[model samples]
Target: MTAPALPRHRSAALAESLVLVGRSVRLSRRDVETLVMAIALPLLMMALFVYVFGGAIETGGAYLTYVVPGIVLLCVGFGAAATAPAVADDMGRGMVDRLRSMPVAAAALVTGHVVASVARNALATGVVVAAAIAMGFRPDAEPLEWAAALGLLLLYVLALSALAAGLGALASSVQSASALTFFMLFLPYLSSAFVPTGTMPAVLRAVAEHQPITPVIETVRGLLTGAPIGSAGWAAVLWCVGLLVVSSGFAAWAYRRRTRR
Candidate 1:
């Protein structure tokens, strides 16, 4: 009970949590249909945006180039939100409670879901990027720049999935997670996902131009195209960090509360 022992115990808990996350990832691999469904929707978005909808949208840059980054960002949100319903499903099924009762690490429970979500995000990103390239969008950035853009895309997902997993855990059901995810997906779609901020309604355009997703999308576009990677890029990073911190903290608190009860 001594305060001096608290830090050591917490460290041990963290280690256990990480291991559980790994196990969660392994178990998720067996969930084939869920895996496929997660990848499919985002891929469909990529196809629809690039082919079916590309002509109608007029981005300032070449359509594919501009669209690629936005889709990438959108998928990160998609992947994160998509996982929420799964978590909710598990809770309703009492799988989560069963895990809580086991010796498995609590953090691992979150970690596994996050891994699956990220894996799905990567697949989504890959499909979209491949389709974009096929449609004539070429990334002209230096090797390092390309890597940076890819890293940012994944980083955003990493943060988002962590937050989403927490929400999913606390959610009363998977349906609730779906509603929450809709808001997450809606933010970027209403923002700079397909078209320029200038083209939106003046009020919406103002918000779209300044919202968290816009900066990240714009940053990726610039990086991929070797255009100026501006302040918006940094703003995008800050947004990811901020959201991650807030959602992750809340999820942790919620999980503790749930477990304690």
Candidate 2:
């Protein structure tokens, strides 16, 4: 009887999560300004780097090609950060309290925000890729390479979205939740995103080289440009997997604490 009940419980949890995911996506659609900014800021940054700063930078090739991967990651970061406010709003407005009284699974709330974030990032990424191509950024990746790059990016987005949700659960207000995620938006600038790390000062270079963002950016850039990825690919996989595990656990713990009576 217990074994039979477990599967039924799991199925109910999944159905609850799917319903919450739809709710989150609808909320995102109504927030047109945030969605537009999430998609637009990356395009504006890509253009700035390619047209203005691209002429001044020496990347040993087209700056546009070297910079698109970074811009793509930046777009993902922006899209994921929006999850924090959504989660926080739910927490602050007593929605979590209302849901707690229902038969819904507690984890379903965070899962909804996470799934909605991934969908938003996917759309923003597609728009950024189209814009990059229009701005003369070309990639030499075959289909498999493209697949690998996108898969890794999806992992990174999942990790960051979970992290944002955790931060949101701990925040006292929606504004604080947004502030907590600002680091995600700024992290790529310290990586090999816009320029080579070797060009930086020695300390900054070390920080850029050792951080998780650098390896992820390097792996994507290599896969897209047909350059040697070396060990960056392996490092990227490990980093994304590690972050996902840690962030998912953190989100679960935070949500439980926040919703406890």
Candidate 3:
């Protein structure tokens, strides 16, 4: 033999993942309504928070500055949640069966959706940041801080997308997949993404502070606004890494179980 077959198969799997990622991205582009809503909903929420609710909220500074990071996470939530339906559609329509009959690797299927989710979230985030800036959401972050924030966001999106893909695999129908992924969109509301966690009641505040989203939001906020990150950055990293590992494993397992011959 020329070399180990395992390495060759690994290379083939990577190639398949890249090709499927392109397919997923193209599918997303064709679905203009979903893409538009993913961006527009976040912008509308940002505007509502900045103009409608900004006056009432007290974050010790401009509300726009305080809330933009939260909105960024919310945008991520919307973008990542879309992966569930896409994967679900593929499964329900027998696309997965067709792919499975080919040389396609099961991991590549979920990887494609997760990568596409990250790409969509990146585009939506850029739009949200631009709109927020136009609406007076100024950030004092240096380039390094901005890089850190983006890196953390990438991790969070990867984790959520993997989780969404797993949920999609486990769902019996596309409608059920949509319902399963709803928690991704609702989770930010319970985080410090909007108002300060201190404003909530004791139990709600405890939940908000302890949840995965809160530390991620806090880390992003601190990076952008020059606030002290302290331990939140580390916590965010740990949370993202943990979620990514667990969700990825779950996605792989769920895909196998759903597609077993």
**Backbone N/Cα/C clashes per model:** 2, 0, 0
lDDT of 1 by residue, 1-261 (tens): 656632355466667666766665665677777667666766777778877988788765667777778777777787778778766676677677887886656666666677777877777678767777876888888989888888888778878887777778778777887787677788888777788788778899888988888888888888888657679888988988888788778777767765676
What's the TM-score of every candidate structure? 0.87, 0.96, 0.96
Please give, for residues 74-146, the per-residue lDDT of candidate 3 as tens digits.
9999899898888888888767778888867768888988998999999999999999899887899999999
The per-model lDDT (C-alpha) reads: 0.76, 0.93, 0.91
Which candidate has the top score in lDDT?
Answer: 2
**Native-to-model Cα distance after best TM-score fit, residue 66 in candidate 1, in Å:** 1.2
Model 1 weakest lDDT span, ten residues long: 1-10
For model 3, give the 10-residue run with minimal summed lDDT.
Answer: 1-10
1 or 3, greater by lDDT: 3
Error of 2 at 108 (Å): 0.3
Candidate 3: deviation at residue 247, Å? 0.6
Q: Candidate 3, residue 186: CA error in Å?
A: 1.1
RMSD of 2: 2.1
